[model samples]
Target chain A: MRRRRKGSVVTEILTWVVVVIAILWVLFPFYWTVITSFKKPADVFRLSSIPWLQFTPTLSNWQTEFTQRGPEILRGITNSIIIAVFASLIAVALGTLAGYGLARYKYVKWRNQSMAFWFLSQRFLPPAATVIPFFLLMKSLGLLDTRVALILVNTTFAMPFAVLIMKDMFRELPVELEEAALVDGCSRWEAFLRIALPLAAPALVATVIICFSFAWNEFLFALVLTYKKATPMTIIIAGTEHTQGVQFWYVSTRLLLAILPPTLLALTVQRYIVRGLTMGAVKG
Target chain B: MRRRLREKGNAFVIPAIFWVLTFTIFPLVYSFRVSLSKVLYGKLVGFAGASNYLRMFGDYRFWGTLRFTLVLVLISVCATTAIGLGLAIVFNRKMKGLRAFRSILTMPLFTAPVALGYLGVMMFYEENGPINVLLKYLGMGKVPWLSHPLWATLAICLVDIWQWTPFAFIILLAGLQSISDEIYEAAVIDTSSGWAVFRHITLPLLSPVLGTVIMLRMVDAFKAFDIPFSLTSGGPGTATRTLTFYIYTQGLRNFDLGYASAMAYFLLAITMIIGLLFFRRYRELYE
Candidate 1:
């Protein structure tokens, strides 16, 4: 181990202390939401002392949610899931093929640059700029409050990231492996589907998970496109706007269920997120 | 054979192309057309051309929201990046319980924005709120959290910081892992102090990731709505109304589709320029 000066040691300690506090500040709300969710509406605010856990937690609020808003929330969840699944599938599938083409095939002059620019534009655009337009178009198409609209937007939003990442992954795979396969009886499609897709599975998995999170957590577009029929999980959370003013416990229970998808998704894919982000950076 | 391969490649790309065209390209074009037209009872009417843009420029609420949005983005980006970088450096240490710390740290990033919005409203409510409660605990009196304009800014900032710093942490932590052990080893052998190592090595190495994070966070901050929209509804009298809220209010609530589309176009222009700059400069990092 290396030696450090006294001042450096103090700086390090202070840094950690600040970070620990910030982390607590960051996480406390989510913890609070979950804690408040499982409690009876009346007991929700009363159990401030046991903020971390509830010993005699009642299922009344959860039951209320199940009885009244359960189907509504489920519909939203199903919409979110279907949209996310389709979006992720389309995005990753197209992205992999696009990536392979860019990585392996030579294009005419300015073709690469144009394609590169197009990909970059898609990747870098903030959803805010594009969402307003989507609302109007969806209304015109009579696609408002539908999973199709959500799926379309989600895939477009995710495609750039998918392409960028998958390309990097494909580029790094040894050309010799593909060449070796070509030397055998394999055509390009066979080489890609069999050789490249299998090799890129980890990256593909990472891309799908990341895309799902974005789609699942999206709010602004969902609010615009869907009213109540096809509301997403994010919209459901946003639906608690009046609950804050109207009924505190009802709001709390609603808030709890709203965040379940993201919480479950993030925790499950926690390991993959860290690795996918890192590897894609260096490889790209 | 090349033609066949090209056909196959286009076939593979069909799904993505169709999706983008329908959702993104079509929406953008429709927004442009809608911005130029007047809305008549849920139907688009005759084209108004630059008249809508002119009206948007004249609208005080639009400018007010746009100004607040600019300030919000600038301040939040600076605040979050400075603090997030410091925390990332600390977490990079060989600390005890780092894994648990990491998982704990990311919980904020995982929380629903809508839920977190209410948490802010609750925290800063004038009476019986934790913020006030904590103030009393610290021997300080309660501060007006939502009543004052500055206080409203503070409320939004606190929520923004609370929600997004975890994202910064995750991105930066991932960046930190990519730095080779040998580089630090070499710096240590050179008798470089921690400051020197950080200033000379880590800063430059992490700039790419930092740039990406800043761009993303700024774009996000500019588009901030759900928290402020849900929490304050752009109040204490339009204090927290962001450009996005303005667009939604105009387009949806007031049903003034023309003005809203114009405002949305302004937003699009600003973000487009910023995004272009971000990618152009930082993209070299990948190369």
Candidate 2:
């Protein structure tokens, strides 16, 4: 019994050790970015890992980014917010309706299963395959480098997640409520809008968050489709490279700015993150 | 009333269907047309026949980058999944601070890949980055992380693994938690060895989740762009240029629109094949 007890204790210690290592591995890059964003240009080149020990942290980089680069940074942030919000709103609105339809109604021609699968398959169509075409398409419509163009493209990509997740959500919801509402002289639209939609609120929130994050973090489409006015935070962060071979201090500040929104959003909806990311596959 | 309601129900899906057809299917068809025609300055000048597709046969860069991308996908997917599974197993047991640990662990999943890549630029800096500094303290030589081809590839892979392992961990952990405790209790009665219980009971149960995770990771990894774009710029003489990166350069940078469109279709075909194969094998998971 003593021997078994000792073995269990050793295993517990080992597990904690692994946990600590995993935490450091996950966090160290973030720590490095945060500290580097605070470091002066000279201090940034230093091999110092600890803040206030190896180098003095400063607000100078943030100051410069805000003052001299203020307009550019603000433009990127505003564009990112506007594009992500509008795109996600459209995606969710459309996806919820489609998802509810697929869940509740049976289509003879397409079939619900095939329709759901088609939407899911759209999620797998790589940005690479579509980017060139999107660029050309946007250009021809005179919408290249416009927020509207990005909103449209982002909606296309984000809709798949909304459809798939909401489909699953509605399917899991009991049909009895809607059936009862229909029997009570309620119109089908009324039954859905008043009954099913309200009950699927949690799933709606999850889908919105996921869609928003996907649009916010989107890169390739933004890279290909937008140039100046519609440039999102991602492109701005990447654009740092072209300006005199990548000023790390400036880039670090921008990097933090770019990630802050999505990070906070993800944490707030932490419970739904696995399901969101997996398109409701794991049901976390 | 029933027929009218059914028509309205179908109408719910129309808006979404219209959006997809306009934005996705239309672009794909347009891209296919562009691929077949010769282009000058983004305008289709003439029919190129099969020239663009045939050009790939002789393009060493296309073949080389495709090979490199496959290697990256294989390594990144395997490593991320393995480490994630290991961590999931370790954290499967109840403990103090597990929630906090999990929250911190999943932080990378939400961060932008481009930001992470730029962070990687500093983290893997050859001279004075934290990693090299640590190596120096450990009495080891500094790795030319971004300068050398091999090291650059390794750096990109490490960054990918760092960003994605949490994704695998969370999903697999959920998978682990879903297995009822009574099964493990039953197995424990048969064998006191934890390894025996895990190998026999946990492994089989977790296989379905594992399969899903692997398929998702493979598809995502196959389209990797942001990291290589920011980190290496496909540098060290295009040593780490992925197929997607290569296609980007061909179409956007070089204005080889015809060839880029062709290559994009090629990539699309491969991606669809992989998706279809996984769907065929794992149809039940989706249903």
Candidate 3:
């Protein structure tokens, strides 16, 4: 008993040590970024980490970004918001219908399982493979360097994720409820919208959050698809280098801008994130 | 009634099917054709029958980048999974402030990889970056993080691990949670040593989740571009250039569409093979 008690105490202390380390590892970069954004150009090269104590905090970088480079920054933010929002909305809408179809009905030519797998497989295709083709397709359609081009690309990529999550969610839901609604003299579409869709509200919200976050943070597509007018915040952040070198001060501020929306969205739907990320593989 | 329902359901899938046919299937087929044809400045000049594919075999840069990519994927995936699993195991027990801890830890998952790469530039800066600064405070020498080839690769992997470890942790933690307390209790009763119980109970039960998290991380790591692009710029003489980065440069920057298309198809082939193998193993494990 005494030996076991001693061992447990040791394990408890070790566990807390690991926990503290994990927390610091995760938060330190974010902390550094936030603090760095507040520092002046010279102070950025200083060894000061603590705000005000090690060095006086200034908003020169943020001010310069807003006043001097405001239009460019605003354009990126607007494009990112428009693209992410539309892409997620379209993906979730189409995915929910297809998900319900796969869950409710049987197809003879291509089995539901195969169709669902087809959607999942699309997610595995390296974006590199399709990027050239997508660029060509967009260019041919006169959609290059446009927000519409990005929205179309982002929607296609995010749709598979939405389809997979909603498919699993719809499959797990009890079918009897929809069946009972059908027997109550409701049309199939009516039963779906009134009963099935409402019942899957939590999953719908989760899918939307995940899809939106994915589209918001997408970089490669934005980098290739847009030039000036439709540039997303991601492209703006990555292009923070000047002739001298990378302007770390400006990059820090821009990163905070690009990171804010998706981070907030993820926090709001924290519970469903694991499920959405894993495609409902593990029920978080 | 059944026939009517089937038709309605099939109609519901039309929009999704149409979108896929236009965006995915059409693009893939076009890419294949582009891979087979010679293109100059994004315009098809002539037919190049497997010459682009044949050129890759002679290209030393292609071989070097391929080797570096495989190494990066292997090391980063393994390191992320190990650290994530370690953290999950340690935090699996009931503890105060666990939810807050989890929320904070997983924040990286939602942030843009490109943004994180930019953050990495500051965090890993040699002269006065936080990491080197801390090492200096501890009376240690500052390592040249971005200048040296090997160290640059390590820096990229470190950033990748930092961003992705949370993903592996959450999934594995959920996997851990799903394993009932009864099994652990039963195992503890049979063995006095904690290691024995963990080995006998926890690992076996967690294998399926482990397999899944590894596969997901592998695929993501294989397509690594943003971090390398923003962090190192594939610097120290292309030491950190990924295959995707190579494809991006060839296709977009150099306008070598045919060669880039061929490389892209090569990447797709590799990804598909890995995915198929994983699925086969997954089916066997479940069935």
Superior by TM-score: candidate 1 or candidate 2: 2
Q: Write the per-residue lDDT of candidate 1 for residues B153-199, one digit (tens) a residue.
A: 88888888878877777788778777887888888888557788888
List model 3 lDDT by residue over B99-184, tens digit each: 77888888999999998888988989998888998889899898899999999999999999999999999999999989987787
TM-score for chain B of all predictions: 0.93, 0.95, 0.94
lDDT of 1 at A106: 52
Off by over 4 Å in 2: A1-6, B1-7
Q: Report the candidate with higher lDDT, 1 versus 2.
A: 2
lDDT of 2 by residue, B202-275 (tens): 99999988987998898898889999998888988999999889999999999899999899888888788878
lDDT tens string, model 2, A58-141? Answer: 999999999999999999999999999999999999999998888887776776667777887886788888898888877889
Cα lDDT, model 1, residue A225: 85
* Highest-DockQ candidate: 3
DockQ metric for all predictions: 0.38, 0.56, 0.58
User: After superposing candidate 1, which stretches have Cα over 4 Å from the reference?
Assistant: A1-19, A40-47, A51-56, A243-246, A271-284, B1-10, B95-97, B180-193, B283-287
B98: Cα error in model 3, Å: 0.9
* Residue B249 local lDDT, model 1: 81
Predicted complex 3: DockQ: 0.58
Q: TM-scores across all candidates?
A: 0.89, 0.96, 0.96
